[model samples]
Target chain A: MEFTSETTANGVSELSFTVDDIPGVLWSPADATGNHPLVLLAHGGGQHKRAPGLVARAHRYVTACGFAVAAIDAPGHGDRPRTEQDEQFTAGIRARLSAGEPIGPQVATHNAALAAKAVPEWQATLDALQKAGHAGGPVGFWGLSLGTGIGVPLAAAEPRITAAVLGLAAAETLAEAAARVTVPVEFLLQWDDELVPRDSCLALFDAFASPEKTLHANPGRHLGVPAFELASSERFFTRHLGEGVTQPR
Target chain B: MEFTSETTANGVSELSFTVDDIPGVLWSPADATGNHPLVLLAHGGGQHKRAPGLVARAHRYVTACGFAVAAIDAPGHGDRPRTEQDEQFTAGIRARLSAGEPIGPQVATHNAALAAKAVPEWQATLDALQKAGHAGGPVGFWGLSLGTGIGVPLAAAEPRITAAVLGLAAAETLAEAAARVTVPVEFLLQWDDELVPRDSCLALFDAFASPEKTLHANPGRHLGVPAFELASSERFFTRHLGEGVTQPR
Candidate 1:
């Protein structure tokens, strides 16, 4: 994997790289003199590395909390070309949604496959950033929907991450993932999410082995996640990754 | 893959082979002087090739319908070694079932992966059997639950299979698979299945593109699948596969 780094005039640098052809972006405080805390951001399903939600969250964590944020497009999303499996999945989703059929099972099936592919990509990216001296401090995580589906499992397997924000998904295939994760977590749930079952979502949260966790359930649909939740997540990160000096003098 | 063949006292020749280290059993009527129809059977999750349901069904097909039947242990069953993914899947199932949580999502996730692995194995077995002269006639399929999950997709992808029996499972990830299947189908649904949602099962049955298909829904639990359903499946296979002169005398 190779990265192209660009520093903007506003003291923020954007680094683009590919791991096993998975496109990813990393945002960092360009003016930082040394290593900084890293927050690996995972985007929801059907989204990309630079998704607006992730971009806004990344920037907030960088400028507000002094962290380097990284995100990669999940398989078959963003700039990556669609494979045969992706086409099958997209066609199935479209057809099922049109018929008003339940899509939860199909999503879990595909997400499990994507999660297997994504976890190592995040690990590889973290390794690359550490070697470049741009990251390698306390690591935290934030993800929603598809992001949560993939991020929870990835974070569970990786010990570097100490905190997480997971939202908007159920535990069908994620129970095992949540059980393995012992990191502090702030889990958000959209109570009226049409595509996700409330009981399943709560079960995933309940399965978390984390010693410290808080559940934030808001009254909204899947897309109607309240914007205020972002602030709540930022504060969670601040308390975890921002307590120490992000950079050594 | 190596094979050990034994001609039993009942005049049934059993060929046990390992494909990619996956164990399988082939049952053929030794009295048949020539080629006969071949039916591939897939057992459910956590069950192996020697599963009582699959074995009894295979024997009836061989003796009653004179069809050569074959079944293989799914990736983690029988003699095949359990992979790390398989271990994760087993742990997930155990945790969910123990907690009284829905195992559907976990089932779909692991089945999808196992399905992906099992499909090529079936094709490979067919290719090997054809070369060995033990198979290569009208091809049909039979599987329920985990079997249906893997069998439906396998039958859909293999045009040589002229008929299939799939049921006792949901349509979550099977819509695309059922769409690709145009062969005759005998779908069996066990009503009141504690684990599989009924709506999802019917939806899958409705998604089948096959012009010749029958849905037989019985009132019973998942494990309480009526013993008579086997008789119904037998008639369906016989109607589809028994009419042709499967042997070249």
Candidate 2:
């Protein structure tokens, strides 16, 4: 199914779009009228729509707030075509690295090309949202983990996005990304989290360019955030997306 | 190759322990004196020691502050024995869940048992530390992600641990774990992180059994704790470990 439409408990309209050409899904509230701000939500590595609790919650918030939400599944994940060959390729690269062999320039270039191949699809989705009349003045993006890696470049490449929330991601360091981002952003950090180091995030945050930025730390493990803070996320999205656009019913 | 030791530039001892009987490496800092406190550091799922920068930083902090640190690699990761069969098993389980197929009770039980198997080994590690002539008074724990998962039970089972710093973990629902944790605890939260919900963390904090609880929020993503707060971690270990240890050189 390329897209599906449904109604929420509050009698609002909702849509879930599945890109046949890609391996991901996009969701939006039906009540998001023309010129409504669009929020594109990105998932973490090795996860799909259901992995992060925040996505669903964010959906609910944006829906109530009159903003459209789009949740995307990255390449090699979800319903996207994946093969043992791709896995083997990654494995081979990993093996070489583990054996203390430097990656040949060809291998690195091939990987980069593959990554570049996925960008247009993501950008196309953003364009589609704008064309659908759901995008307000500028788009907003929220990415986690690998999503952050992709989102950073996307945001930088497309000036159409006016604001972003890059949680656990950076272009160089958290500080560098922070400095590069001209939009309002909120960075989240875990004090004792072991998956992503504290230093990386701090360095990124230090590099943020916006004075409107803020850093929030909460207790919970990696892959455990959505279950930890549903209300706060609602508040954050609502604040950024605008008033009365999202409110818990 | 069972264990390797190095003195850091700052004069702290970095030690890695390998147990042939187990699948992973256990890294820590050699105690300055035999009488220093001991802390067990656990990592989250699908991550090695380097993934969570806080683990090593915490180890360094505790060691510099005159405590011993032990970091363990969990099952299915970090120099652990893993085979295609194990990957298949994990994939099968995930596939079944994704397809909405009912999981057999046997499979569930088997998986649960595998997780439970680590408990004794963790306990025995503490015992080994004690036998090594380290001062056993006021043992503590620090964990993020999977580490948080294991630390909860470990803290409950091991009465010797006096304090803990838990980031990005839910012992149970925040409500259940908070009620159960009788010791002083500090929780870290990232407000916009998607992997774990922020609400759950807040709920857990509210449920703490002791009054000596603190919540610190920072900005970043699901990658474990942020980097800028190494000093805070040092202070935390120092306050709990008791005085007389020197700060990092």
Using DockQ, give the best candidate's number: 2
DockQ of each: 0.01, 0.11
Looking at model 2, give its docking quality level. Answer: incorrect
Q: What is candidate 2's TM-score against the reference?
A: 0.44
Q: Say which candidate scores most in TM-score.
A: 1
Query: For candidate 1, what's the TM-score of chain A, rounded to 2 decimals?
Result: 0.94
Worst 10 residues of 2 chain B by lDDT: B105-114
Report, for every candidate in turn, its global Cα lDDT versus the true structure. Answer: 0.79, 0.58
B78-113: candidate 1 lDDT, tens digit per residue: 888889988888898899889989888788778888
List, residue by residue over A117-216, the lDDT tens digit for candidate 1.
8888888877777777757688888888888888888888888889999877888889888988888888877656888897788678778887666566
Interface RMSD of 2: 4.7
Model 2 off-target regions past 4 Å?
Answer: A1-12, A18-20, A23-26, A30-32, A50-55, A83-86, A89-119, A170-178, A226-228, A244-249, B1-249
